[model samples]
Target: MSDLLERLRGRGWRMTAQRRVVAEVLDGDHVHLTADEVHARAVTRLPEISRATVYNTLGEMVTLGEVIEVATDGRAKRYDPNAHRPHQHLVCGRCGAIRDVHPAGDPLADLPDTERFGFTISNVEVTYRGICPNCATTA
Candidate 1:
């Protein structure tokens, strides 16, 4: 996403070739790539790109709100580029495939005030886990 790079530029992010490659790897619909995956892909374009550089670039992107992290199984975190949209994640418990899903109602509303515990409620993220079509067919 060139737009993302431009926005990062506007925010004074130094444009590096490695960061650009990483961003390109992240740009697309339903893209949920882990850091190792990102580094693997980025290495194809930037053979010199190190894992530390990729991690730093990802951290910067997250700080800039250009990417959101999803911990599907608490093992590895996936980076989502669709930060502007409000949605939840549907993860395949078997194959670990992830899909973005939109629910019909307000999920946060399900938590009534009684359960708020006197803290300010701001946002909600729901992760639905099940077998994906491919995984189901294979099984």
Candidate 2:
């Protein structure tokens, strides 16, 4: 079983066939796939699964804090299953490839007192954009 599946089961999540397939499709490293991409992959494993089911399952997972919905640049939102970890995203400027990057230090602590305008900060999102090695080699 995948980590996401294990976590879901630990949380007493109901494991339906459609939900299982969606979770299975999302199990992997560097897996940042859009809803359509997830639906397409799920169809390969279970042809009867519907797009609505995938979308709804994803929404529920996000609501449960089991998945992260990443919207990079105006493109379709991609779902990431690394919600339990503290990390940032590395985006490929050319192909829009996304990878989970664990960099040293805390971004939340980097903010100075004056930088904050009286609002208490709870979370910080940092995105690093660059041409990935694959894109650089092909260029």
Q: TM-score for every candidate vs. truth? A: 0.94, 0.92
How does each model score on lDDT? 0.90, 0.91
**Candidate 2 backbone collisions, by pair:** none
Ten residues in sequence with the least summed lDDT for candidate 1: 1-10
lDDT of 1 by residue, 47-122 (tens): 9999999899999899989999889998988999988889999999998889999988997889989999999988
- Candidate 2 lDDT over residue span 22-78, tens digit each: 999998878899999999999999999998999999999999999999987777889
Best by TM-score: 1
